[model samples]
Target: MSRIVIILACSLLLVACKSPEARRPISSKSGSFIDASVARNIKLNEKEQAYIKKIMSENPEEEYIASENGFYYFYNIKQADSLISPDFGDIVNFNYNIKTLNDDVIYTKEDIKTQNYVMDKQELFSGLREGLKLMKTGETVTFMFPSQKAFGYYGDENRIGLNVPLKCEVSINSIIDN
Candidate 1:
């Protein structure tokens, strides 16, 4: 009986000493979903860019400059005398109207109302935020943004639709330095 008890204890100790086994997932991902999404986004960006290019080409009278931040803009009222646009942390008072690429109005200046944006400190859309930095006081510029630059996959949750590019005319009333 004593020998049996000692053997059982030894067996139990040996069993407990076994290394933990790694678990095999029931289903493994091949990363297809992420790859497909990336490919789709790339294709979408290309199509939007081509369309914007067409619009620019068609409008020979309007001079549009492509921004480094992946948008296009032309000055309706350019202030050449101002040496610099609004810097970071500046309080910018502006008004803007939104439109589709086809020039369909989504939001009028009165509908949106005048905006007071604290540069790089407020919760504004990515494109408009970047666009504001390129504007001086009393300058109005019309910006053409790709969907990704504007709102990306999610629209404005109201009038704007999914993956819709936009044209916005922005006028800066004043820029108060912070």
Candidate 2:
């Protein structure tokens, strides 16, 4: 009787673990979110030029850093982990503002109380998601995300137009295990 009861319990547990939707794969239409023309005409402003120059000069190794799939470059990382084994899955809480290298404000959530956002490895763009994953909590890095990794080479027409260059200021606040 005890053996039969144990078998029944195991069977019930197995059945409970199955979800009808688990076997199906998520599908998305092609070109549903792909744009490649946004980074086409990027013009850097005086202030942006100054900052880029300063950072580039301060960190000569920056030029050596390879780019990801998009225009984003990981350079002069203040407190990044080693390249051999970088942390790419950590959850980073940060406050970011999107703008054009020309200092044109594109997106800002300054009114929010926390002014911070959480980024997951798979949830963000290829460049941004990969870039932030390389940093530790409390790490601050400035990266220029070309349209390819951003809204794609073609930008969101309602927000930024096609082929426009964009920049994002990122500051990692904390790391959370999601």
Candidate 3:
């Protein structure tokens, strides 16, 4: 009898703990919310593109490569064996400095210790991860990314702000195969 009572209590608790999406209020204006979100994202993308183009034009001497994923990068130093790069699941160690396109430094390697992450596994900024994948050990490069690629609408909520595009100077110190 006690087992039956415990089982009923557990079932009730499970039913009460439904996911937020399952418990969300269904509103007649739900479609409008989605439409507004899409429109806002489109505008932000346009702003980021314009900022990148302006920066590129300002630095006429530096050659920049545009990626299909909507970012740009230029390497200051390239590794001799360009064919070798970090693969997914590999551990990569690097130092980086992050800044706004307006040249305001947000963070740098000096502010923290050398960083390490599993390539394509950790939730490091998407743009930084993509840029790292393009580099081999001992290569250093600067990558510029749109707000969407960097921090999206909310930004980092600390050093970075909302809808801000970013640039990162990355040095790939090493890549350890797992």
Best of the candidates, lDDT: 1
User: Scored by CA lDDT, what does every candidate get?
Assistant: 0.94, 0.58, 0.88
- Candidate 1 residue-wise lDDT, 1-178, digit = tens: 9999999999999999999999999999899999999999999999999999999999988999999999999999999898667888999999999999999999999999999999998898899999999999889999999999998898999999999999999999999988
Ranking by lDDT: 1, 3, 2
TM-score, cand. 1 vs. native? 0.95
Give residue 12's lDDT in candidate 2 (0 to 100): 100
lDDT of 2 by residue, 73-108 (tens): 453346545332134454556666678766678877
- For each candidate in turn, the TM-score is 0.95, 0.50, 0.81
Candidate 3 to truth, TM: 0.81
Give the residue spans of candidate 2 off by over 4 A: 1-64, 70-77, 80-90, 109-122
Clash count for candidate 3 is 0
2 or 3, greater by lDDT: 3
- Give the per-residue lDDT of model 3 (tens digit) for 1-178: 9999999999999999976665666655558888998998998798879889999999998899998778999988888875679999999999998888887989877985699989988898788888888899999999999988898878888878887888888998988988
In angstroms, the error of model 1 at 144 is: 0.3
